[model samples]
Target chain A: MTQFNPVSQSAGGQASFIAVDWGTTNLRAFLMNQDGHIQAQRDSDRGMLKLGSAEFESVLSDLLGDWLTPDLPIYMAGMVGSRGGWQEVPYQQCPIKLEDLSEHLFWLTTSLPNKVAIVPGLRGTGVAGLLDVMRGEETQLLGALDWLEEQGRADESPIFCLPGTHCKWAQITEGKVTQFSTSITGELFARLNDESSLVKGLPKSNQLNEDAFKKGVQASLQAGGILHHLFSARSRFVCGELAADEVRDYLSGVVIGHDVNDTLEALKVVSLEVPKSPVLIIGSEALSERYALALSSRDLTSEFLAANEASIRGLKRLANRQAVSANNPTTGAL
Target chain B: MTQFNPVSQSAGGQASFIAVDWGTTNLRAFLMNQDGHIQAQRDSDRGMLKLGSAEFESVLSDLLGDWLTPDLPIYMAGMVGSRGGWQEVPYQQCPIKLEDLSEHLFWLTTSLPNKVAIVPGLRGTGVAGLLDVMRGEETQLLGALDWLEEQGRADESPIFCLPGTHCKWAQITEGKVTQFSTSITGELFARLNDESSLVKGLPKSNQLNEDAFKKGVQASLQAGGILHHLFSARSRFVCGELAADEVRDYLSGVVIGHDVNDTLEALKVVSLEVPKSPVLIIGSEALSERYALALSSRDLTSEFLAANEASIRGLKRLANRQAVSANNPTTGAL
Candidate 1:
C-alpha cells in the first residue's frame, strides 16, 4: 500500500536501481528511483513452480520487456535459485548477513544482455541440531531489518517470522541473521484440506472461525503429550458441532499450533536463554493476522509486515548497498 | 497362507456363496465352499475408487461369471459400503456384537440373479471422547472374535488393530467389538513419501527400516508437546546426515511416531482400569511386524494377525452364523 513514483527525481537524474523478488510460484518486480522508493511494481504467475528451469529466463525477459532493457541490473530472490528452479544456487548457512548473501550470489546469464543476480537461500542449524534449509524469504527479513533501522527503532536483536508456503523464523542480531528455522505449515494445511480425506467432505473457503482457530492453537500450544489433534477437526464435524466450512479454520489452527510449537521449541533449544524480545511477523495480511492472533493468545507481542512490501524493501536495500559500493571506493565492497 | 479344505458335506450337493473384502483401492474375492474354504480366489482392479457406483454389480458379475447365479448369496465387507463405495450403509454404533451388525444388516438387490449383502462399517465412541467411524476392518474384527470364540480362547478381551490405509483399532471383549478407533497414519505416510516434496528425492522400496521405524515409534511415544518431530525425517535428509534412500526409513519413523502417540493416547482414554492389556495388530506383514517391535520396546506384548486372514475368517463366521440362524429359529445367532 506504500505509494512511490518511479519517475520521481531524487537529487539527481540517475535512478537508484530496480529490485525484483522472484519466487517459485509468483513474480514481483519493483522499479525504484534513487531513494529506495518504488516507482512501479508488477506481479505475475511466472513463478518458479510454473516456469520451472528451462523457461525461467524467457519468462523473466517477457515480463520485464519494455519496462527496461536486457542490460538492466536485476536482483532476484526466493526459490528462483533452488535446485528445481532456474539454477542450482548453493545455500548460505546462517548466521548470515546481507553482505554474506550478496557476496555469494548466483548470477543467471541469458541470451538477453542483462545483469541478473539471484540471492542465495538460507540454511541454518535445525532444532534437531541439523541443518535447516530455506529459500527467498531470508532477503525479506533483511528488508524488514532495513525498514526498522530506517525508522530509527532498530534493536540489537530481533525475531522475525515470515509465514507463508514455507514459514521462516529468523533471529536477526546486529544486522545478521544468526539463526532461522523453516516450517512447511502452509503446504501441509493445503495438502490436508485439498488432497487428503481428512477434510474431504468439508467445503473450501477462506472463511475463518476465530473460536475454532483459537481453540486449536491453544490445544496445540498447551496439549502436554505428543498426540496431534488435527483429526479432531473431522471428529468435531462428525459430532455435528462444527460446520463443513469451519473445517478449514480448524485445519489452520492445527497447522499454526504445530508451527508455534516448533518455533518455540527451536528457539528454546538454540537460544538457551529465552529473551523477552518482541516478535515481528512478516506474511500475507490474512496469515500474518492469524499468526498475530496465535501469538497474542500465548501473551506474545509481534509486529506484522506485509510479505510483498518486505521483499521489495529488502531487495531495494541490497541494490542500494551494491550501488553505493560501486560508486564509492572507500567503503569495503561485499 | 493358511490353506483350508472345503467341507464337501452339506444339505445340498452344491456350494453357493461368495465372500468379498472390498477396500479403498483393492478388491479381493473368495469363492467359498460349504465348509468355509476358498474354492477359487480372485482379485481385480475394480476397487471402490474405480467403480463409481452403477458399475459395482457389473464389475462383480464380470469377475465372477457363472458364480453370480441367483442361488448363491454374496457377502461383502470393507469400504464397499462407505459413502464413496457402492452403497452408503449407515454405520453400526459400538459396544456392538456380531449379532447386532447382522440384525441391522441391509440387503442390496442387483440386476443379477444372486442376492448381495453389504456388511455395514462400525462407528464408536472414540478414545478422544468423540465419535470414531470405521468400515471394512470392523467386520474383520468381528470375524477374528468369532474365530477366537470357536477356538475356545475368547475369555480375555483382545485389542485387534487392523493397520493399513486407515488403521482400525478395535477392542474385542467377549467375542464382540465393544469399541474402535481409526487413524489415517498409513495414508499420511504414503502421501508424504510418494507425493509430497518433503521426500521428493527418496528412492522407492517396500523394505522396512526396523531401526528407524522403532526409533520413530519410541520418539512419538515420548515426545512431550507436538508432532513436529514428524518433519525430522526431512531435516535429517536436508542436513546430509541421511541418504535419500534412508529417507523412507525416516518417514517410517515419523508416521509410526504419530501412530504410537495416537494409539497410546487412545488406549489411555479408552481403558479406564486396564493399563497393560495385550494388543493384537493385524495388517500387512511388514507394518504389523514393525508395530509389534515398537510395542515390544515398551515391554508390552502384541499378537500379529494378517488382514487378509482376519477378513476371510470374519466372512466365514458371518456366513456360518447366518446359515445356523436360518436353520434353527430358537438359537440366538449373528
Candidate 2:
C-alpha cells in the first residue's frame, strides 16, 4: 500500500477535510489531512432524532465549530438526509456506485460560511418485494471494500452484517453493494424489555444470560409457530425457571431466531448460499459478540470488524477519490 | 323441548355450582343453583396476565365469598388452563365432544371446602391439525348447541365463529364440537396498534369510520399483501387526506384486511365448498360489527350472536345437565 504525505498544494498551505456520520441518536465527525491521517474527532448528541429540521443546521454548526474553522468543507452522511433530518434528500437505490451517490448529493451553505455536502443514503426494493433503507452504512461498506482492495483480497462476494439499532446485512460484489436487508431487532428488544408485558415483572440487568437466551432461541426454533413461542416466554417465567433479568435475553433470542429464519428464507429465495461462506460482522463489541454466538449456534464462521474504523476508512477513501478527481479532471470517475 | 322445573327441591337439594370463564385480561363468574338461575354474578381484574398459580385460589376466594362456600362444584374454563395461565392443563385435541371433555376432566380442590373443576382447553396436533383454547366461549358454544337442539335444528352442522380476543371458528356436528380453530386477530391488533411503530405517530380515536374501514377491506381483498396496505394510513396522514382521529379507521382497515385475508386463507385450507353458507358470528357488538363488514366485503352472509348470551345459556345448560345427571345414572354422557 502507498502512503501519501500529509501535504497539499493549496494556495498557501495544506488544509484538513471533515467527514461526518450522523444517525438518529448520535453524531460522529472525523477530521483528516491530505494523507488520510485522523487529526481530530468530535461526537455529539445533536443527532437527527433530538434535532428536528429547523434546529439541525444551527446545532450541527455549533458542534463542528469547536473542531474546525467555519470555512471548512464538510461531508456528511446518515439520517442527516432522512425525511426527519436536516434535509429530505431522496434515497439513491442500491446496486449504486459512489459516483451515483455523489451525483445526487445535497449541499448546504451555513450562515457561518461552511460548505457542507451530505452523502445520500441507499434504498432498494429487496427480493422479498419490500423497501429496504440505509443511510451512513453504505458509505462505510464502500470504505470496507476500499480497504479489502488495498489488501488485494476483494474478489469474493463477502456478506457484511452491520448490527446496530437497525441491523443491516449487505452483499458486496466487486466494489458495489448489490443488496441488503434491515431488521429492527435491537429496537424490538429495547421496546419489549422497557414497555411490553412480556417482561413486565422482570428485573433490570444488562448481562447476557447465554443459557436463557439459548433456551429461548431453541424454543423459538422448535416451537410450531411465532405465537406459540411468545407464550413460552411467559410460561418460562410463570414456571419459576427464568429470572426476571433473563427475560431480556429470552426476548433477544426470540427476535434473533426470527431474524435468522427470515434472512435465511430470503437468501434461499435468491439462491444465495450462506453456510461455509465468509460472513463479516461490523458493530459494537457487545452486538458483535452476540452475532458471533448466534452464528456459531447455526454452525457458521464469521469475522468481526470495528464499525468506527470501517466508517473512518470509508470516509478517507471518499476523500482520496475526491482529491484525485480534482487533480485529474477526466481520469477519476466522480 | 322439555321444560323441567326444580323450584320445590329441598334447601340441600339445590346444587351449588360455580361457573367461570377466564379470558386473557378479564374473568367473569356466575353463582347458580340446580335450576340453572344465575343467583349472583361477579367479576375481577384477576385475569390470566395478573395472577399466577399461588395467587389463583386466593383471588377466586376474594372474588366469591358465599360462592366458594362448602359443597359447591366449581367449573372453570378459558386461559386459566393455558400453559401461561395458572395451571398447565393439557389440551383436549379437536373433534372433541362434551362426553370426551367430561371423561378427561381434571379437578383441583383445596381445603377451602369447595369442589373445583378446571375445564381443559382444546388442542389439536399433527398434519392439518388445529387447537382452539376457550374457557368461557366453549361453554357458550355448548349453550348454542343446546339452544339448537331445543329448537330442533340440531341435524345441520352449524359453523359458529366467536370473534373476540381470540376468534374461534368451530364446526358443530351432531351437537358436538367436531373441529375448531383459534386466530389471535384481536391480540395481534392490540399489540400492533398499542405497541408497534407501524402506527406510532397516528392519533387514537374509537369512532368507527365505516367508509374508510370498507375501503381498507376492499384494498386488502384485492392486494393480498398486508405491508403494502399498512403504509396507507401513514400516506393518508402525510398527504393531509385523513384526519388524525381517523387513524382508528385506518387501523380498522389494516386489521380487517388481515382478518379477511386470514379467514379466506383458513377457509381455503379447510375447503369450504359453500361460499354463501349461513355462518354464525358470536362476539362483542364492536367485533361482531367488524366481522359483519368483513363478510359483506367478501359477499358472504352471516348471523350475528351475542357472546354474553351464548356464554350464559351455555353455563345454564351445563348446570341443568349436572342437576339431572346427579340423579339419573346415564342422563348425560359425562
Candidate 3:
C-alpha cells in the first residue's frame, strides 16, 4: 500500500482508471493505477438512498472532480446498479464466475464522454431455501476470491463471511459463487439500541464492554435460542446481575453469535457437523474481530480481509477482464 | 359483564375499591365492586415512565377525580412499584403463592388521606439461568390463577402464557408461580417495524395479513432458526415472492412463533417432549389471537383470558387476603 500523496498523483502519476463502491448509505471512490494500486480514494454520504435519479451523474461528476476526464474508464458496483440506484442492472444468475462479471456489466455513456460499467449482482438460493440477492457484497466476495487466487488457494472452496448491517455468508468454488445467505443481525442490533430494554440506562460512551459481550456470546450457546436469549438483556439488568453499560455489547454478542452459528449450520452439506476449513471473514476490523471471536468460540478458525480492499480488488478484476475481452475478440464473451 | 353507564355509576353506585395496573407506557384504573365486578374503567397515558417522582400523587388524584374518596383503598401493581415508578417496591422472592402477595404489599399513606398498597414483583431464575423479574405481570398471573380457581382447576399445574411487549410463560403448580421465562418478542417486532429491511415497503395498515403471517409461522419451523428466518422477509420481497403488505405480518409470525416454541421447550421437565395440558394465554384479544395461532401451529391448544379481568381478580384476591389476615393476626405473616 502506498502513502496517499495527492499532489504527486494528481500532477506526475498517470491515472489509470477509477473504481466506486456505492451502497445504500455511503459511497466510496478509488483512483487506481494500471497495476491495481490505489492512488487516491474518497468517500461520501451521497449513497442510493440520499440521491434522486437525475442526481447520480452530477454527484459522481462532482465526487470525481478533475479525475472525470474524457476516455477514462470507470467501474462501479453495489446499490448503484440496483433498481433504486443510478441504473437498474439486473442480477447475474448463479453460479456466476468472478471473471465473467465484466461481460454482464450494465454500460452507460456519461456526458463526460466516458463509458461507465456497472457490475451486476448475484442471485441464488439463500439459507432459508428462498431466492436471495446481494448487490454490493458480491463485488467484495469476488475481490476476496481474487486475493485467495493470488495466494495459490484458488481450488479450495472457502466460506466467505461479510459482517455488516445484513451479514452475508457465501460459498465460493473455483472462483464461482455457488451459494450465499444473509442474517439481519447487525441491523437488528442497531434497531434494538433505540427501542430495546437493553438500551435503557445505558452508559453514554460508545465503547463496547468486552466482558459483557463475551458473556452474551456464551449465552447464545445455551438453550432457548435467540428469541429467549434476547430478553436476558433486560432481565439480567433488572435482577442486578448486569450493569446498564454492559447491556448493549451483551446484545451485540447475542445477535452476532446467533448469526455465526446459524450461518455455519446452514453451510453444512450431507448433515456434516464440523467445518472443513477456516472461514474467510471480510469486513471492518471491529466487526470482523467480533465474528472471529464468535468463530473461535465454536472451535473454528478464520482469515480476515478488509472490505474496502476487497471492493477495490473486485472492481479492478472486472475492469481488467473488460480490457482483455475488448482486445481479444475471441474472448469478448468473457 | 354489565353495560358501562357512567352517569348512573357517578351518581349512586357505591365505590368498592380502585384496582390499578400502571405499566411503563400506560395505566388503567378499574372501579370494582366488592364482588370483583368492574363498575367503571378508565385508562390513561400517565404510566410510571411518564410521571416524575413528585407527580405520582397528583396524577393519581386527578385521574381518580370523584373516586378519590378518603375511605377508598387503592391497590396498584405493575411498573407503579418499579424502580422508576411512584415508589420503588422491592421484589418478592419466587416460588410465591397468590394468597401470600397481600402480606408483602408495599403500603404507603399518601397526602390525599388514603393508604395505597403497591404489589411487589417476583424474582427468580430466568431462561438463561440468570435472575429474572416481572413487575406488572405477576399481578396478572395471580388473577389468572383466580380465574382457574373459579373454574375448579386451582390444583392443576397449568402453564400461563402472557403475551405483551415482553411475553411471559409462567409455571403455576397448586396456585403458586413456581417459575417463568420472558421473551422480548413484541418489542422486537415493533423495533423491526421501524428499522428493518422488512419495513421498507410495508403497508400502512396495522392489520395482520393472515396468509403472510401463516407463511412466516411455517418458515419458523424450518432450518436456520430466527436469525436466518428474519432475512427471508427481505429475500422473498427482493425475489418478488412476498408482497409489501405481507412483510410486516410475516415478520410478526417469525418472532412470535420462535417465542412460543422456545418457551414451550423451556417448560419441558425430565426431558418430556409433549405438553401435559392446554396453555392458558392471558392478554388483550388481538395479541392473544396471534399467540393462539402460533401455538396451534405447534399442535398446542391455548385458552384466552382478558388481561383486565385478571388484573381486577388478582387485586381483589390480594385485598381479600389482606382482610382475612387482618381478622387473624397469626396468619398475617403469610
Candidate 4:
C-alpha cells in the first residue's frame, strides 16, 4: 500500500520507459530511467481479471495518465498477456534465456502512440512429465538472474522461486531457464482456511504466530504426505494441542513446508550440502519470509528479492535487451 | 436417491425402532424390526448443518412423522451428536467396542414422548500421536466389525475405511476399535473441483471416468507428494494431455490414492502383503467403489459394506447390549 512517487522536478521529465506487472488480481507500474532505476511507481487493484480485453488500453492510460506520451515504449508482464488477458499471447517454449524473451514478445498494436509489448509467458515440462505454465513469474526470474549477475554471482544458477497464488520455482542453468514447476501452494492454503475443518472454530487474529508456523513445518516433515498432514491442523486443534488462533499459521507452515520440500525432492536436491547455490526467493515480504523459514528448517539457504523490484528490473532488462537486439538483429533472435 | 417405503398394514404396525444416520449434509432414518432388519427407510436434507439446535426435535419428528410413537426408542449417529448438532455427545476414547457405545450414549431428555439416544463419536490417536475424531463413521466401523464377525472373521483385525466428506480409516482388533485416522479426501476433492484451478474449465458430467481416475492413481505413486501431484491435474490439462471432463476423475483418483497410500504408510502396513486381512470399505457404493479401486491399485484387497445397513446393525447391536447391561449390570459394565 506504499505509494512511491519518485518523479521529481530535477529529472526534467526524462523518464525513459514504463514497466508494468499486471497479474490476476493486481497491477503495479513503474517509471524508470535509462539506467533501469525506478523513478516513480504506482499500483491499483485493476488486475487482468478486472479489465475487459478492450478496456485494458484505457485502464493503462488512466493509471499512467501523467506518465503517458507518444513513443514511451511500454513493457508489460504476467497474466496481462494470458489467454484471459488483454492480448492472448502464446507461451514461449522454455529452455529460454532472458535475452530471447524480448524477441518473442507479443507486440500489441494500439491506437495510442506508444509501442506496447507484453512479455510472453513460459511453458515447460513440470514434475512427472506434466506441462506447467507461468506468466508473470518468468519475468521475476529474469530479473532475479540479473540481480545475481549484479552481485557478481552471474555464474551461479540458484533455483529462483516466485511464490504467490501459483508459486513458480525455476532452475536457471547456464543463464537459461532449464526446468521449473508450479505449485498451487498459496491458493491451496487460502482455500483450505476458507473451506476445510482446520479453520472451523478458529478465532480470527491479525498476528502472525511464528511458533505455530514452525510447528506446522515440523508436522509436514513427518510421515503421511501432505494430504494426511493437512488434517493434522484440525486434529491437533480437536485434541487441544493447537490453539484456535494458532491453527491458521500452523496450516500455513504445513502447506508452505510441503511445497518447498516436495519441489526440492522432485528436483532431486536431497541435501543442503549438495546444492552449492542458495535458493533465490522473490515475492512479497510476508510470503518470502515463510519460504525462507521453511528452507532454513531444511538446512537449505535462500536469498530474498522484492517482487515489485524484480518485476521492474525484469521489464527494464527485457526492454534493454530488445533495444540492443534491434541494433544487431542476428544475435538475440529467438 | 432410491426411497424405500416398506411399512405395511399387513404387519399390524410392528415397527421395532428407528436408526438415523444424521450427518452434516443429509439425514437418513430407517424404521427397523426387532431383528435389526430395516422395515422402511426415509431421508431428507435435514442434516445437522441445516437445523438449529432447537429445531432438531421438530425436524426429526417431521422426517419420521408416521413412525413416531411414545414408547419407541430412537438412535441417531454422525454429526447429529456433534457440538453444533441437536445434542453434543462427547466422544468415547478409542479401544472401545460396540457394547461400550450404548453406555456412553448421550441420551436426550426431550419434551417428546419417545426415548432418544445420540451415539457418542470416537476420538483416537491418528498418525504421529495426533488425535482424530469421527462422528458417524464409528457406527459404520462397529457395523463393519459385526459383519466381519458374521463372516467368521471376528478374530481377524482388518482396516475399516468409511469414505465420505471426511473419510475414516479404523483398525479393529478383537472387536475393539483400537486406532483410526480421518482424511479429508472427499471434502478436499469436492473443494478442489468447486474452487481450485484443477477443475477450472472442466466439463460437467455425472459419469465417473474410471480410466482417467486410474491414471491419477498411477500418478500419485510418483515423486513430489500430494501437493505437487495436485498441480499435475491442471498442468496436464494445460498441456492437452488430459481433457476437461477427465480432470475431475483424475483429481478424485489422486486424492483417494494418496488417502489410502498415506494412511497405509502411517499404519506401517507397507506393501499390502504385510497385512493379511483385506481392507473393509464400508460406505455408499459409489465411494466404496473408488476406495476399493484405489486399494486394488496398490495390490491391497478390500471388502465393502453398505453404510445404511451397517448403521442399522450397529444401532441394533448397541441397543441389545444396553438392554442386557440393564438386566445384568455388573456382567455388561464397561
**Cα miss at B324, model 3 (Å)?**
0.5
What is the C-alpha DockQ of each candidate? Answer: 0.21, 0.13, 0.58, 0.55
Cα lDDT of model 1 by residue, B129-149, tens digit: 546677778777766765666
What pairs collide in candidate 3? B78-B136
Local lDDT at A244 for model 2:
71
lDDT (0 to 1) per candidate: 0.69, 0.64, 0.79, 0.79
List per-candidate RMSD values in Å: 5.2, 6.8, 4.6, 4.9
lDDT of 3: 0.79
True contacts kept of each: 0.09, 0.00, 0.74, 0.61
Error of 4 at B24 (Å): 1.1
- Give the distance in Å from residue A129's predicted Cα in candidate 1 to where it truly belongs: 2.5
True contacts kept of 4: 0.61
Off by over 4 Å in 2: A1-15, A33-37, A172-174, A236-247, A272-276, A296-299, A326-334, B1-191, B205-310, B324-334
What is the Å distance of residue B280 in model 4 from its true position?
1.6
Worst 10 residues of 4 chain A by lDDT: A1-10
Give the least accurate 10-residue stretch of model 2 chain B, judged by summed lDDT: B124-133
lDDT digits (tens) for residues A25-87 of candidate 2? 889887766656576788898788788688987787777775556435577878888777888
lDDT of 2 by residue, B46-99 (tens): 898877778888888888887666566676777787766767677665666753
